[model samples]
Target: MKKILLLLTLAICSWSVLHAQDDTFKKYRENAAGKLKKAENDTTNRLWKKGATLSLTVNQGSLTNWAAGGDKFSLSIAGAFSGFANYRKDRHRWDNTMELAYGYVNTTSLGGRKSDDRIDLTSKYGYQIGKSLYASALMNLRTQMANGYLYTDTSDIFVSKFFAPAYLILSPGLDYIPNDEFSLFVSPITARWVFVLDDSLANVGSYGVDTGKHVNTEYGAYLTANWNKKVTENIVFKSRLDLFSNYKHNPKNIDVYWTNMLTMKVNKYLSANVSLDMIYDDDIRVFENKNTGVLGPRLQIKQVIGVGFTAVF
Candidate 1:
């Protein structure tokens, strides 16, 4: 009987030990699963990001008596806004950006004139295919916010206005993004649409649209390269180059747009900015000389420098 009791006791102890080990393993597994879920949620939340920067610059000068033959009274004001939103989830990514700028200058000799105007928006969606490479589709829109004019001694000729020369481009391409500082995109098939909403401008066949037509379409190949880098702790540089070739007409005459900017930050609220822009389009004509009455395509260039209040968020 004692031997049988000892055997029963040993069996009972074995059962209890096995039960305890099972419970411990179950709790450990549950804890590990909870931690994994929390980590996944945190990663998902970090996939989306957004930021923006806004700047305003103002300058004024007055002279009671000046020997340099400059404007007696002069004032200039400029403002710019740039913003971006980006998302990444697994192999998919989306990026959107908007940029706006406007400037005005007034002097005793020139009166009030617009010195700069721009509105640009871009959105790109991409799926990763290889190392640092993606299959992407991009949409871009460019236009002006206000009336643009050519200043002359006698009169200011109305040249362009809001929506009068809006451009929309759509492309599906391959993007090569080696790092955060540079990217290149190329598309063999691209579509571009030009809109001249103003009745007068459409009637004059402005911006490559047919006479009296409000819209023009073209099939082309597009290429764009972008670079953004911090040259120093307080300085940044950004540049972009865009090229397009129409497959249907004048393919040899490619359109080009190049922009560059340098920014030096003084603090969280102050900065200095310099920008240069160049554009060339065969369809746009410029008057070379009024006396000769010659009109032809020409390269356009603009530069701006300013020190101003800036905010980034």
Candidate 2:
């Protein structure tokens, strides 16, 4: 009888041990699955930290005669496209963008002329300074065909040759974000150096009789305000205001340019946009006469309407 009791006790202990082991194995499996799910969720969350967009537009406009040298009525048709991609990991940020544009213009008096094509590349590195502030360093490079005109009293003349002018700008600035959709950026002071590929053009008579290659160093300030609001789930309104000034240089070279853009979604792939740009340049004549003899104070207003499509993968 004692032997029988001892065998039964042993059997019960064995069964309990087996059940405990099974429970432990099940718990471990569940824990592993939970960890895997959390990891996947973390990865998906990181995706929102990175974003990109591409935009293309065809624009047409006219330049009305207002300067000492220019056409009475000029028509311009151009196509421009730009793209940006950026990524942020925790407190470190990196971004890059590129733009390309080309166009053709016809003046009633000057005949038909092809526009200069251009390419611009920019990159930035940033560090989070606080909850709403960031310190960033930026580098921008631009190259473009020189397709300007020279105006004589008798006729409008196009440039006979093409030159590529490139420049580099390096700036370190602080950005302020008041909220998710609105922010203000101010670069209180910065140094800008403009590059001219060929000193030969500086000696060209078209720019000015006294035009020569001069190293231009300027102390400038830039401020920008951005606002974005969603009217609906698919419709959005965006506005930007930019102001720039060269305090230590010629006051006639200061400029302020602003634009307002509205975008409406027609579908998942198509959108409509209307943009208006106002430019006030103290030296508009300088840009116009960069390679010409015509000179005067000039003002410009530009309006554009277009449709665009985007695809996401």
Leading candidate by TM-score: 1
lDDT of 1 by residue, 50-148 (tens): 899999999999988677778899999999999999999899989899999999999998899889899999999999999999999999999999988
lDDT of candidates 1 onward, in order = 0.93, 0.63
Best by lDDT: 1
User: TM-score for all predictions?
Assistant: 0.87, 0.62
The clash numbers for all candidates, in the given order, read 0, 0
Return the lDDT, model 1, position 83. 97
- Model 1 misses residue 54 by how many Å? 0.6
Candidate 2 Cα deviation (angstroms), residue 136: 3.2
Prediction 1 TM-score vs. true: 0.87
